[model samples]
Target chain A: MTTFAPGRKASSSRRHPRRGEELTFWIFLAPFFVGLLIFTLLPIAWSAVLSLFDAQATVYPTIFVGLRNYIDIVTDPDFLNSIGTFLVFTVFIVPVTLVCSLGLALLVNRLPHGAGFFRTVIFLPTACSYVVASLIWKLGLFNGLESSLANQVLALFGQQPIYSWLNQFPLFWILLVTVRLWLQIGFYMLLFSAALQRVPEQLYEAASIDGVRSSWRMFWSITWPQLRSTTSAVILLLMIAAFQAFDEFYNLVGAGPTARPPLVYLYNRAFTQQDFGHGSAGALVLTLIMVVVALLQNRFFGFGAADDDSPRKRASRKKVAA
Target chain B: MPGIGSTQISRRQMAGILGLGAVTPLVLAACSGPGASTGGGGSHPTLSQWYHQYGEAGTEQAAKKYAASYKDATVNVNWVAGDYASKLNTRLLAGSGVDVFENNAINIADARAGKYADMTSIIEPIKDQFSETALYNVQIDGKYWGIPMIIDPQAFYYNKAMFSDAGLEVPTTMEAFYECVAKLSSGGKKGIFLSNTDGGAGFSSTMAWATGTDIIASDNKTNGFSGDVDALAETYSWFRKIQQNGFGLQGQPSDWWDITPFANRKIGIQWGGMWSMPQAVKALGDDVGMFPMPPSGSNGTYALIGSNWNQQVAQKSPNRKAALEFAKWLWVDQKQDQEDWALSYGFHIPPLKAVAASASKLQSGAAKEFVDAFTKYGKATGPYYTNEIGQAMEDAGTNIIVKGADAKTQLAAAAKKIDASLATLQ
Candidate 1:
């Protein structure tokens, strides 16, 4: 059963074990790297090349345009407006999602029983496909048909239900925010709940001794500061999710100028119009913006970077261990 | 996309398998190529055919049956459901097993890129038998790129009983149509459904035609919207009001393509196509009726528009000659299959004039009315009106009506963008 393969352990005990472990580690990692190379890395590099061409109706680049696609996508008003939509969406969604999920986490955490039940109930929407959820929201709930559940509620109050929900400006935003929140709040709430459980019980006892008796005061003085890392992570995730939002805007609103985001705009430009050149350029630009935003977020929050790294704290920890 | 199952051969064998994630499936399906082309390069060559999922029952079966009957090759049919154009375009670009497929029309740009085989030779001899509108959809630069399969005309399909109950007449003008919507909407019943969202893309595209102007200018120079901007705006303003006020059905459980909302009496009028006729008649009996998109004024014109699905073979298909022969046989040579396609599953008009003329199911009642309307007012967007141009128009319509942007400003912006798009074509 002796083997010559680099990753395999030698049958002779005299052979070095370290080489086999190192080789085995690489062998196990090869599939993921291969997948990354083939699926992700190749397409991205190709997409970069595609951005500089006048390619249309085909994947392979034909005529070299040399940043013409970039110029067109940048100068385009619809694309600019989509960025504005992204900003507005992020501004509305991020803070609202954080507050709602945190509030729900607190309420669920305080429950004497059924915390697991409430958690499951809240988390179920996250399991459903975004496409399926968006379809249900558009076609079933907000379809604006007189017999639709939304309109039927209005009927119960003897009021006429006649508004075209998806087309209206404020209503469109309201419905979008609501559906997205419903789909994501449970998952974020669970994150908060997990962080909440990790907060030391001694902190609450110490806070009570300090005259911070009110629950709101106790949370603000102690719990809120303790959950800063989780909050920063949540905010970062939420911002990325907001930028990537496409299913609801597309399926519910049907690619109208009123609701289109960058992804939807890029999809239409590339797939719908068969203009791969511009689509690739537009995608790279959006990716650039996302990277900038993430960098800015890291600078502003300093969440993981600033935690307990002071020289005094390091010395104190060493003293305690000694 | 739809899994091409329920085939008479073996449902499990002809697998149009969907992969993980919604968007990922489109890429996976396209990248994987055609299904079950076993025995390729042998004496028995196989041709791969694809189709968008038709809402009509038995259409998939009919497609598979047509493929099975072709003894020259083992034809594998893939029935794609949503967003078929993207999937088809990606597949054609991959130069995989895509031998032949159906689409609204063969994209001239794609053909110019050498993706589509010129169908002029296949269609030339039988040109006289095809409908003019059908030919216009698949023809470009004086060369045929696709063979017309079916002419699906979309128009107003109203509930006869509901209209009568509301003491209304079939609207013949834009004003009367507005009045009908307002009056018919009461007691939990909606007036109309022009798709479930964006107030209907079909309605927006045909609005200019309804106002006595074609979608394109003379010699395919530019869009005709620049000719009559005010008429476009005023009509759109009215549409906005109808949509905003809830006279029209917006958020229906089903799309305007389905007549279920109409049949269930939730809507008095529905903007539907000829394909929904059989189900409408079966459910509502004598309750269904047909009409055109009403003219804007005394000076305006009646109009209707639909995507004419055309069949085309790929230049880089696995077996191009066999693929061409199969397309020619099923779409042109087999008169019985053509007639059955036109009449059996749904009420689509066969491209062949001979088949359309003999379709008995379309000779009387609801089907006849649909045919009459189509014959009189059927309109097709010019080849110049590509997706970019069409999207420019749609964006203008959406901005004006939904976002409440000034119509003149929106139209001007649209005009500028469309001019740029048209510039690319030349």
Candidate 2:
């Protein structure tokens, strides 16, 4: 019998390990790839194809009208108006969410006690479905009935009842903004809190020793700068979410000329009007807008860059330079 | 010294968790797909019937009971809830499962696209049983595509107690109606509640009819409201004036479909349907009365009448013959079930004249008055009155009545849009 060394088996296994490892890696990745291909990639491809046809109520399009659908949507007054409405909504909602969520995160982060309790309390609304939250806001609070909570509060201040806040333009923005802030601010606050924790304590101590007595100054110098990446992410997400606003508008404001958003307009065009070609074209146009905005934001903020260069890394680099 | 934290999970474990997370939904979907079919595994052919979820109790159970009684094929009743029209349209396009369905109005475009089957042979014998107007809606190119289910007559329901207490006679003219509204707006009660916010949505058709003008012309090609645009504008101006003067409720807690405002004495009058008669009777007992839209200029008062539901067979159903047999048997042959469907849960006029004549609820006081109004002043919605056209009219009316936009301009713009949409249908 030939003598066998104990380490030879290990060496032989290492030499041929990559094939099995590769197979296992693919096995783990297959489900996700398959799902993404079937649900996301296929629908996107089909929508792009659909945008070129004059498909009405039917599944198959007999007439291929190239660029006409796009031209019609661009010139369509209603589609343009819907885009304007969404922009107005985003302009107001995004900054308000950023400020409010940051303020909340700062306040919660500074608490010596009951921080967890307050964080959970603030984050509770995020768990609620948008539809349910919208209905509660619409029917329970701003129902336009004299007996509603909002009107009751108004009555306490010796003001007359204001019915149907949704019907009132510009004033209804307050309602939409309030509900969105209530639902979304919590998650963003958590994100800010996590980023705040990763901020080095030594920097704050050093700043305090350098005679920086004001908390505002310290925050502006340290905390805000430390949260640059998180803030950029929050803003990008908020803009995308604001652009895709449909549920709250659909549930609260309903279909009317008053507050028709782009998605709702697209829905009416596709399903209600049975003009699939126009709907698909509108969707592609919306997607293009979102992509352009995201690219612009990335260009300004450099979000795609790896944010691994900490103070230590910079100091080591400075030492090398010296 | 520790290298990595002991609490950290291994890469293999992480991969396993992520893989499970992604695979779970797909596996669940695969497992649940076949179980979703309501048809049991048997030799008998199973037919799927769809109905929009009705608000009234016992409607679903009644549908199930009716389906259970059909022995020719196993009938699976699918009570669809929320956005039924869109869902039905999608399923019909997919061309699967749906053997029969209930539609409020048949789309002529869908009919031309071969979405619905021709039911003329089944209805030709009993076609005389249904009213002429009911038959008129389903007839496309001299062929019936659907069978009428129920007739819902919409009119204004007034509180008799409030009217009598105010010593107000039922107003028969537009001017008299305005005076009645003004008189009723006292003692913490408003004169009328048209709808929650649209300020009388469906009533525009009634108003046009009352003005002796058709909203959609007989030819279904041109705008009918254009015939007497000035008169229609004047009528809308009167609505705006009433709204401005606070004679009508500006914003109520309930919508136009709800009879609660009139029942609870919150408003003197409300635009409601015959479907809510049971709720009105339960709340106001003998204190309720019905009236049509008061005559505007020289036309007689008009009651808005439309089909509540119509049974249709999907043209793509594999078992179309069996499905048709089930539909005719249930909707046509069984008159008792039809009456039950109309009168038992919530009040609706049976489409069959013979069944309607024998309905006990239709022979009495308030119900009888409603029936009489429906018979005398009833105006059926034209076959060409589609959801798109309805939406245009609503928008124009809202602009005129609520926002006080120029009525002639708004109506003209609306007519233009309607003509364009109707052209597409042609």
Per-residue C-alpha lDDT of model 2 across residues A21-74, encoded as one tens digit per residue = 655656668878998998899978887778899777776777899989999899
Off by over 4 Å in 1: A1-17, A112-117, A145-147, A155-158, A304-322, B1-42, B159-169, B186-189, B297-299
> What is the lDDT for A214 in model 1?
98
- TM-score for each of the candidates: 0.88, 0.88
lDDT of 1 by residue, B178-290 (tens): 88888888765568787665665446767877887655676676767777877877778777777667677765666778888787777788888898899889889888898
- DockQ for every model comes to 0.40, 0.20
| Number of backbone collisions per candidate | 2, 1
Which ten residues in a row are the worst by lDDT in model 1 chain A?
Answer: A7-16
Q: In model 2, what lDDT does residue A247 have? A: 88
* Native interface contact recovery, all models: 0.59, 0.22
| Residue A169, model 2: Cα distance from true site in angstroms | 3.4
The candidate that wins on DockQ is 1
TM-score of 2: 0.88
Candidate 2 lDDT over residue span B160-279, tens digit each: 998998899888877777777888887645788886566674477888888888778888887798978887887787788776665666445446887877888877888888989999
* lDDT, model 2: 0.81
